[model samples]
Target: MTEQPNMDAGAATGTKPLAFDRWLEHFRGNPAYHRLIEADIDWNGRSMLDEPTRQAFINSFQRFELGESGDGKRLLSKAALEGDPTYLAALELLVREEQKHSALFRRGLDHLEAPSLEAHWSDAAFTVLRRALGLRTELGLFLIVESVAMGYFTALAERAPDPVLRGIGLRIATDEQDHIRFQIDRLRQGFRNTPRAGRVLIGMAWTVIAGGAAAVLAVDHGPALRACGLSPARYWRQAMVGFRRAAHSVLANPGAEPLGPLGKGVH
Candidate 1:
């Protein structure tokens, strides 16, 4: 298969807007893209980290795996109500890719001789808070989550002690960025007709949500961040940086560049 999806992960630039249909094609064609990533992660059940660092990473990883391990049934039910066949179909494939992230992390844990966790307070809290906001699936929440993930994985790739974790980070970073932009495009479409003042208000709300999520994650995943040579504060800042870029792309303009990374190969 192709090394990358066949579409740029287009989320409109601050000066333009992105289309949702392109995202559909990207997910449609690359259904099992994780297979490509797996070939490169050849860790045959080896613990590559020292004990102290290994435990920290395992603690953090188990939480991430728990979040990614969903089957998307809840979300698909929501999509069915929305009656958007295209998005529903794309989302089904997207969920598979998200599950792949869990699978990859699970494999890493097994290789490290670690057990996946049954639950995490942060995961539960995030869910509670997300549903607590009663808006049309808000899509902005996905933007916040994936934005954090993209930067978090990049840190793992650059600073983690283990080559296998680094490989998984690098591979998953691509998918996470695409996921971020997918949500961005969807949000952009929803707000395309709103007045500038309304968009600004929405952006402000989004930024606040992003900030809150970033702060909590900084604390929630602090140990792994430290193990990987990234401080919680620094990781939080990096997450905000990505979120701002995405927010501007979605709420700034409808005639600018998109965060298109699918066909172009994600950075």
Candidate 2:
């Protein structure tokens, strides 16, 4: 895949140039994963979780479900205006995949006999933040969220009592890992030509964002994390580890991090 034109960066900051074609192909080939998760997991049964854990999971995943519910219209508009066509295409698929997550979460809520929230302050905050910034800045914030999500779902996948719920968690976590890399790729390319001083400021901001986000999520999802046998302290630690891995990789001079594999059929 050819290196697409840059937004501000002269070339990709990463040693590996941007390959939006492969990214697009990767997104296109991954839809089957969601379908497999849906088919293999029986999402129609009632939760077998203990009373406290059951309600906690319902509340927590519901919030996350709402987080994934946004339609991404503004995001797509920004992508079209300033990003590579191939990236915009890949991003559209990414947004659709997030929507699929919402559907899966909705099904999970029904299975747990819980009603989904009509609104959430956390979801509203994320919407406002993304809309408040440029595409690059939005992506930076998005990367933090995705990185944190990887930790949250991984906890559940490994520790949640319900096997079906664990299945859902693992599938979502798998997708989030890819999503984090996608954002990192875009960010490295976007910021490649940024002056060292500007990079410093950006890195500082990301550090604060990463720290604050981990704390807030730990508090908000404390019950669910505890139910999954992950303490808030441990969850925060894991979240920060993932966050630093993503943030540093993006803030680095030339990312040597390899792009994840081509999806099943995209190779």
The number of clashing residue pairs in model 1 is 19
List, residue by residue over 1-267, the lDDT tens digit for candidate 1: 011111122233343323446667788766456566667777774765788888888877888899898776766666555445666788788888889889888977887788999888877877776564422334667777788667789888778888898888877787887888777766655555557887788778778878888887788778888888889998888899999998888878734444554553357
With candidate 1 superimposed using the best TM-score fit, by how many Å does residue 205's alpha carbon deviate from the native? Answer: 2.0
* Best model per TM-score: 2
| C-alpha TM-scores of all predictions | 0.84, 0.90
* Residue-by-residue lDDT tens digits, candidate 2, 41-130: 766666778889888989887898999998999988877876367788989999998998897788778878888989988888878878
Query: RMSD for each model, in Å, please?
Result: 7.0, 4.4
- What's model 2's overall lDDT? 0.78
Model 2: residues with Cα > 4 Å off, grouped in runs: 1-17, 255-258, 261-267
CA error at residue 91 for candidate 1, angstroms:
1.2
Candidate 2 lowest-lDDT run of ten:
1-10
